[model samples]
Target: MKFADIGLSDELLRAIDESGYNEATPIQAGVIPSVLMMRDIIGIAQTGTGKTASFVLPMIDILAHGRARALMPRSLILAPTRELAAQVAENFEKYGKYHKLSMALLIGGVQMGDQVKALEKGVDVLIATPGRLMDLFERGKILLTGCNLLVIDEADRMLDMGFIPDIENICTKLPATRQTLLFSATMPAPIKRLADKFLSNPKTIEVARPASRNENIEQFLVKTSERGKRDTLRSLIEAEDIKTAIIFCNRKTTVRELAKSLQRYGYKAGEIQGDMDQSSRTAELDRFKAGTINILVASDVAARGLDVKGVSHVFNFDAPWHPDDYVHRIGRTGRAGAQGRAFTLVTPSDDEAIDNIQKLTGYKIPVHGGGAPAVDVAQPDRDEAEAEPRRGRSARGGRGKAAAKAEKAPARPAPVAEARPAKPREDRKPRNDRKPAPRHDDLDGPDDGWNGPMPGFLSVGFDT
Candidate 1:
């Protein structure tokens, strides 16, 4: 049904119009009315189904009447990642523009002072990541008791990120009588348990079957070595008549390195990971959505709820470790009824991952043998690495030399006296003759908070 047919406020309808959406997405059409009627909701839909607006639009109307108090937000929306939280906050601003609703974004990697100020001014809608939200709550900077409407977006992701405990804690603080809305791309047991405990007689909406893929996407698997994955991705990007694509990687280090490699190869690419400053992440996403950036190399943070349009391809630089992620990664393309393509780079080691993904989707991704010559995987230059001074090494004569000397070298006695002056045996020591150096203690530093240079997923754009 058209958004206008739903009982949305004129202002919201106008915003939807400007967004160029007339008919609502399945999830939106199902959940919005129930949310508007003040019912708790458990929404099941895959990524790119316009689920953000399912809650954001109705929330604006419900919150339009209440004024937020300093440190006491009237409503709360919790997201699994900082990027998702920020995007939710953006939706509030976009839909609530005509209304005077105030909102705040609480996430990590930003100055807390600004968030505190926003909380103090009384926010009508507070969008937050679970970790940072708890930090503020403990500091007495945010009070959850007054929150009437609660939204836990990406509930399954919350479980993946180990935020369930934090969510349980937040739930204990909220008013028991408040309305709750929970949305997830898939309903794993953990997420379902969360819904059972929090939602009261909720209306369940499933827009698509769980873990199913969009039929419009042409999916394929490229069997290659891990080292060849990057080269394969570059070739696909170069050869395909691609408009835009999202390249997914599993590790942040790989993400950063891949993005840099792509850019070095003269492709317009950027990186986003958990460790980046909030402003930089925002700027990167802004550039991507505006079509200025051809590729965004990110992590799982970009897998869900990212609404950029016209993505023509998806490149899985690394196979997803989690089977569910395979669905979300491919879901980035073939959105809005448009035909799209997805290519996954798999190594011999990824056979299990490929099997799991196939089992989950119930359709085997076609395997292609020879695409292009895979790029040479980089190997640490042993000579260059060894050239660096041996740490803690002393020029001490050790037993190693004696042992070496005892092992007789072949006697190259007298070279035939005839020709050129007989060359003396070169005295350069064998590599093993050097005494082993003590290892540097600093090399053991903890990597606990490392957010790697690049996020795990990358997106690039192309106009159809």
Candidate 2:
């Protein structure tokens, strides 16, 4: 259905059109109408399904008539990560340009002075991560008692980040008569219990089955060794015509290192991790979004609620530890019905992890690129690992003592020999008269095989 038919204001519709969106996504189409009717909603849809707009669009319309009081926002939206919270704020800015709604973003890694100022002026909407919001609430910079509309977005992600207790605390601080909308990609029991305890009788909407793969995304897995993961990722990037892509790593250090490696190879790559300050993270993301950087190396922090359009490929540099993260990482691509590709680099050690992902998704990911795999070392199964060969002294058995004794046995005297004058009728020149051999690059013919000098990355304090 069209955005115009959903009872949105002309201003909101104009902003939508300017953003080049006319028809709503399945999730948006399902939740927009219900949200406009002031009903609590439990939306079950995966990431990248336009779920952000599902709430943001209607929240604008619902909050248009209200004036926020000092220290009290009219509506509250909670996200699981800083990146997700910032993205939500961007959406509000883009969609609410025609309206005069004031919004504040509360996230970690940033100073609270400006946030306190925004709260003092009051706001129509407050988007925040759980940790930062509570910090502000404790300092008496903001008040949640007046917030009548509450949205706990990415609820399942909250549970993963260990934010459920914080969520429960925040829920208690809000007025009991407020409307709560909880949205998630999967409905795990923890999230279900939270919903049952917090949300009043709500309208439930499931746009797609839980953990269901998107038909628009083509998935492939590559079996490679741990040492070859970088090489495999490079090969895939060259093989695919990726307009823009995100490379997921399980650790923050991996994210930083992979991004540096890509940069050394002359790719426009950037890195984002929890260790970076808020300003640096913002700058890197802005560069990525503005096309200055084409590749982003990130951890699971970006797995949920980040919406960047035209991501043609996603490379899992490291297999995710959690099965659900596999869905979120790949979901970054193939968004809004756009056809995309996702390639995962699996190593021998990742066998069990990948298997768990397949089990959760209920399908085997297809193998692609016929040839020697990027990583040839297949990890041994449990049984093989248990039967591993003995090592060192254990493997020597009874011969180790004799071998040590033989090494210390006295050596026989050498047979006397008269040194004979060497005959020098060979092609070798006299040592003093011979010049240095030609360097590899100076040799002639294609057989000489001259590539440029090595990058000297190791000398520069980086890994080769």
State which candidate has the highest lDDT.
Answer: 2
How does each model score on lDDT?
A: 0.82, 0.87
lDDT of 2: 0.87
Q: How well does candidate 1 score on lDDT at residue 37? A: 98
lDDT of 2 by residue, 1-464 (tens): 99888899999999999999999989999999999989999999978889999999999999999799999999999999999999999999999999999999999999899999999999999999999999988888889999999999999899999999999999999999988899999999999999999999999999888888888899988878665567677778888898999999989978887888788789999988888998998899899899999999998888887788899999898889989999999999998889999999987788899899998888888887663474434332222232334323343453343454566788778899999988778967779997444454442433235353333332357458
* Per-residue lDDT over 128-181 for candidate 1, one digit per residue giving the tens place of the 0 to 100 score: 999999998888888898999999998988899899999999999999999999
Please state every model's RMSD to the true fold in angstroms.
Answer: 20.4, 18.5
What candidate 2 gets wrong by more than 4 Å, as runs, is 370-464
TM-score result, candidate 2: 0.81
